[model samples]
Target: MNSLPKRIAKEIERLMKEPVPGIQAVPHDDNLRYFDVSIEGPTQSPFEGGNFKLELFLPEEYPMAPPKVRFLNKIYHPNIDKLGRICLDILKDKWSPALQIRTGNFVILREKVLLSIQALLSAPNPDDPLANDVAQHWKENEPDAILTGKDIVRFSVSEKMDLGIRQAKVD
Candidate 1:
């Protein structure tokens, strides 16, 4: 409880001063530990021309534990589940206490996740996926899967789905 707040405050200050490329994150005024985040879809991925929203919270154990993060925007990715839960090793079983920063409680939150997800966008790992059907589809028919993912992006935009990243603000 003590370390978490101080850490989060430092994190907010850092991010505000040096925002990450393609990603912007800010903590809510009402809840210092809960952040509203946005990540631009990578340029060459099916999600390009889009913005993705996410919510991240520092748990009580914090650096000793990973932040609870989930996508608020729907995306067509094999490593992301229907509920927007991710199957990334860093976010899960591989999380390291060394990720903790003496500077902030946020860990290297935005950078690591952004880079990894960007990499995932460029080169999806279908062998291990949170969305099983999508993974199987990718494995069985790579080209068709790519086509379908692209189609989904187009349709979602036309349909005005809640796929756009929510503006970062105190909520």
Candidate 2:
């Protein structure tokens, strides 16, 4: 693998030193720009108690362009599509080169990508949604939609656990 950019290397080092709560991002041995991320669902949300796996890739453009992040596991969210594409402003037009990965009670209110994604899970926006059907479900019957999300979270977690066990046995 080629050497990582200085900026990316610093960011990764900082991330390792001062880790964010409820979020873990580890780089691949071969590719430092690619991260295997896992975020625990926020409490009081439908996805609570679930560990959502996601992949984050820092492109050549890097801070000039937003990192590409998408869920690797199933998630029932209005802002998230079937393909795990997230409909978040920061990931798109709102992206800024100055954005960092810090979270919680910072002096500046600058947006942090992963933290913003976690916040989105806590407060979903049905009006602007990637998953039209899920958004409609949220708009029409929010309670039912939340219940469905909870069900999906439960199932997804269990399925992941089972897969882990099987892999462990194989190993």
Candidate 3:
């Protein structure tokens, strides 16, 4: 990896000094541009009580280009595919060079990628989904789909434990 950009370095430092609630993003020692992330499922959501693992990588063109982010663990959500590709607008055409990893109080909450993803878990948009089947399920039988999502999280957590994969801990 090349040297970290000044903007990214400052963002990383702020992330460490003033951590976001229920979210953690730690850069790997070998690659500062890559982060190992964990987001605790939002309260009152189907994903509640689950800790989701994800990977985020700031590409060479970073703020001008949105960071690449995807779930490392399986999650049953309409907007998230089996491969963990997210269908969030900010990660796509809405991306802007002015966007920051963490935003100030006045900024629109969804403008922050990580916060948007966390909010996605709380309010999934089945109408515009990345996983067609999951979206169909969500649209057809909403209650059942929610149950399935909760079950998938429980199963994934157990599987992680069986494999000795440590869950990320936020301070």
Best model per TM-score: 2
For each of the candidates, the C-alpha root-mean-square deviation to the true structure, in angstroms, is 5.4, 3.6, 4.9
TM-score per candidate:
0.82, 0.88, 0.86
**Candidate 2: where is the Cα deviation over 4 Å?**
101-111, 161-171
Q: Rank the candidates by lDDT, best first.
A: 2, 3, 1
User: What does candidate 3's lDDT look like per residue over 23-89, in tens digits?
Assistant: 8888899998888989999999999989999999889987678889999888999999989899999
Error of 3 at 128 (Å): 0.7
The digit string of per-residue lDDT tens for model 2 on 47-72 reads: 99999889999999987898999998
* Residue-wise C-alpha lDDT for candidate 1, range 1-171, written one tens digit per residue: 244566566666777888888887787877778889888777887777667788888787876787778888777788888898988887889987676454644545656665676667767789998899999999999888877777766776765544333433323
lDDT of 2: 0.85
Structural RMSD, model 3: 4.9
Candidates ranked, most accurate by TM-score first: 2, 3, 1
